[model samples]
Target: MDHREIVTSLSQEQRDHLTAKSDLPGLPLLLSHWGTILVLGTLIALKVPFWPWLMIPQGILIVFLFTLLHETIHQTAFRTAWLNEAVARSASFMLALPADWFRYFHFAHHRFTQDPDKDPELAFAKPATPWQYALHVSGLPVWRGHVKTLAVNALGRCRDGFVPPKGHSKVRMEARAMIAAYAVILILCVYFRTPVLLFAWILPALIGQPFLRLYLLAEHGRCPYVANMLENSRTTLTNILVRRLAWNMPYHAEHHAYPGVPFHRLPEFHALIEGHLRQVEKGYARFHARYLSELKLASRDASK
Candidate 1:
C-alpha cells in the first residue's frame, strides 16, 4: 500500500487506541521468555532419557517468540517502539528465526491482506466455480498445511537474504545480521555438540508445524474473499494457555484488520468490532475439531 492508502485503513479510533499505554505487558512477559530459554536450554543440556523430548516445550516456546517478534516489529506490544524492538530480538533468539527478515515480510501481510499474489498467507482464497470449489475442499490436505508452514519458512530465509528493506539502513543491517545469527546457531549446533538442531529444528518442523494448518485455515479460509477485513481473517478465541504462550496471535483477524494495533491491544480492537466478528469462527478446537467430519460430508455429498 502507498503511504496514504495504508494510513487510511486504520481508522482514527484505532490509531488513538494504539497510542494508549496499558500495563498488558509487564514483568510476566519478560520472565516468561527468560524462563523458557533457561528451562529449555538446560533441559537440552541435561541429556536425560525422555528429557531429550523437552524439544516439544522448546519448539512451542520458539513459536511464541516468533509470534512476539511479529508484535514487536510493529511496535504494538510496548509503549516505546525502541523497547519493543529490544524484546523482538529475544523472541528471535528463542525461535531461531531471522527477526529482521520477519519484520519486513510481516508488514507485507498487512499491506496486502488476503490478496493471493500479494499476500502469502492467502490460504483463504476461494475457487470461482462449484467444480473448482469442490476440488479445493477435497484438496485441503490437513497434514500438508503444517508441513508447508515449516517448508516455506525454511525457503523464506534464502529469499530474505535479498528482499529489499523499505529504505531503512537499520532494517537492512538487521536482515543481514539475523541471517548471520541463524547461520551461527546452525554452525554451533552442528560443531559445538549442541542439540539445537534436533530439538529446535527437526522436532518442531516434524511435530509442531502441522498443527499450524488448522489455525491457518480458520484464519481467512475463503468461502467468501474480499477487502472486508473481518471476512478475510479469523481471530480464534483461545484458551488462556494458547493465548498466553502463542502471543495472542489467535487474534488473527484483528491483526490483519488493523496491522498497527499490537497484541496486547487486540482485545480492545475485538471488542470494538465485536458486532463484526461474530460470524467468523473463534477458538481453534471449535473450528477444526470437526474438520475431518466436514471434509467427509463434503466428499460424500459431492459424489452423490
Candidate 2:
C-alpha cells in the first residue's frame, strides 16, 4: 500500500496518539544530548590518555545535532515553541547552518522532496563515481555548501525562491550575526594562542561529518522522484544508539508522510506504517553497498 493507504488504515485515535506533541520526551532528549557533549568536552579538556580518540565519538554526537536542528525546524522537537527556536539556533551555530536560511530551505525540501527540478537538495547532484562517492563521504561538500551559504546570506543576497522577499532582510541579518559570532571565536582563538575551538568544534566536526553524510544519503538516495512519500523517501533500520542520536530521523518516510508527528512519536508512527513502506533498507551498510553497485552498473552501461 502507498502512504495514503497506510494513513487511511489508521484510526483517528491512533493518528492523534502519534501526532500529539509533548515537551516530556524532548526535554530528556535535550539533556541527554548535552550530557554526551559535556562528558566528551571534559575528557578532551583534561587531555586524558588517547583523549583524541574521544574525538570520534564526540564528533558523531556533535554532527548528529543536525538531526536535532532538523526536527526543531519542524517545531516537533518540543511542545513549546520557544524551546524549539532556542535549540534550533544553538544547533545551527554548532553545525554552521543559519537557522532562518535552513527553515526556508528545508521547508522547500519537504514541499518538493524528490523533484529534480524543484527540490533544492537536488541542485547538488549525488555522487556518480567511486571517486565522487569518496569525496562526498569526506563531508567536504557539506562544509563547502555551509561556507557558501553563509557568505551569500551575509552579503544580503538571499534571493532564493524558498526565502520570501519579505524574509530576505531578516535572513541576511541573521547570517551576519552568525558570521560575527564566528569571527569572535576566531579572534579569541588567535588572542589566546589556543586551539580551544579547534579541539572542541572544528576537528570534531571534520572527523564526525562523514557519518552524518552517510546517514543523510540513505534518506532519499535512490528513491523514486514521486509524490508518494513511501516511494520517494527511505527508512533505514538502525540501532537504538543511532535512533537516539538522530532523534528517530531514520524513520525518514514516516516523518515525510506525517510531518505533524513529533520526533519522539516516530517509532509509534513507524509501527503503523512499517509494512507499507516501499523503500526500507536494512541498514546504512547495505544501502551504500547497493548504491555503489548500481553506480557501477550505470557506469558500465554509459561506457557501452
Candidate 3:
C-alpha cells in the first residue's frame, strides 16, 4: 500500500469495530500473554536436564505467543488497540522479529499478499525468485538474513522511506523508533559482553528463528489457492503440536478470511468454513515432506 493508504486519520466511520462472530462465548484472551511469561519463567528457573526435549515445550510456547502477536499486529485479535500493539511487540522481541520492521512490511503483506510484485515477506517465495534455497543449503547465518528483515525499516526511516503502500508520517516515525530500539538491544549485549553464541546472535536466530520461519513458510508454502482466503493459507489439521506451538494458527485461512475472529475463536470459525475448504482442496498438512521431495527433484534437474 502507498503512504496515502495508511489511514491515520481514523474518521468516525473508521473507528467502528468489527462485529462479533458468535455467542459460543468470548474468551479471556488476555490470559495468553500471562501464559507465555509463565512458560519462559519456568524454563529459566528450572534449567535442569538441559536437553532438546526439555526445550520442546518452552520453545513451542514461545512460537505460539509469537504467532498470536502477529495477528495482533494486524489489529484483529483484540478489542483494545494499544494492548494489541504491546502484546505484538513484546512477543515479537521474544521471537527475534523486529516488531517495528514487521509492522511496516506486514501492512504491505496483507494488502498485496498474493501479488507477485507487492509483498515484502514473501520475497523468499517463488514470486520473488530468491536464492533462499541456496542460502538454506549453504547454512543459516546467511549474512543476508539480517538485512532481508531489516532493509525496509532502514530505508523507511530515511526521507522517502521505502515503497509503503500505506501510511506516511506516522509510519516513518514508527520505523525510526524501531531502529533506535535495535541499537538499545545491541548495547545490552555489549555491556554484558555476551558471547555471540549466547546473546548477541546464535540463540535468538537458532533456537527461535527456524521455528518462526517454519511458521511463516507453512502459511503459504506450496499450497494451491482457491477462490478466497480459505485456500490462500494452510491449516495443519488437529495436531496438538500445531495448536499449542502456533496458537491454533494453522487455521490460517479462517483467520485471514475473518480477521475479527480471535485466536480462541478460530476453531469455531474453522468449523464454519471447513466444508468450503475441503471442497476446494483436501484441506492442509504440516509436514515438510513436500519440501524435502521437491529439493530432491530440483537437485536432479540441476545435475542434468
Candidate of highest lDDT: 2
Could you give candidate 3's per-residue lDDT for residues 57-172 as a string of tens digits? 45445545667667677665565777677878776655545665566666666665555566665565542213554344332543265444455555654332234445554545
lDDT of 1: 0.61
Q: For residue 39, what is the lDDT in candidate 3?
A: 55
User: Which candidate number would show the highest TM-score if scored against the true structure?
Assistant: 2
lDDT of 2 by residue, 222-275 (tens): 888998999899999999988998999999999999899999889988887887
Structure candidate 2, residue pairs in collision:
none
Instruction: Decide which is better by TM-score, 1 or 2.
Output: 2
All models, RMSD in angstroms:
6.4, 1.3, 7.2
Worst 10 residues of 3 by lDDT: 1-10
C-alpha lDDT values of all predictions? 0.61, 0.91, 0.54
Give model 2's TM-score versus the native structure.
Answer: 0.96
Q: In terms of lDDT, which candidate is stronger, 1 or 2?
A: 2
**Model with the higher lDDT, candidate 1 or 3:** 1
The true-versus-predicted C-alpha distance at residue 202 of model 2, in Å, is 0.2
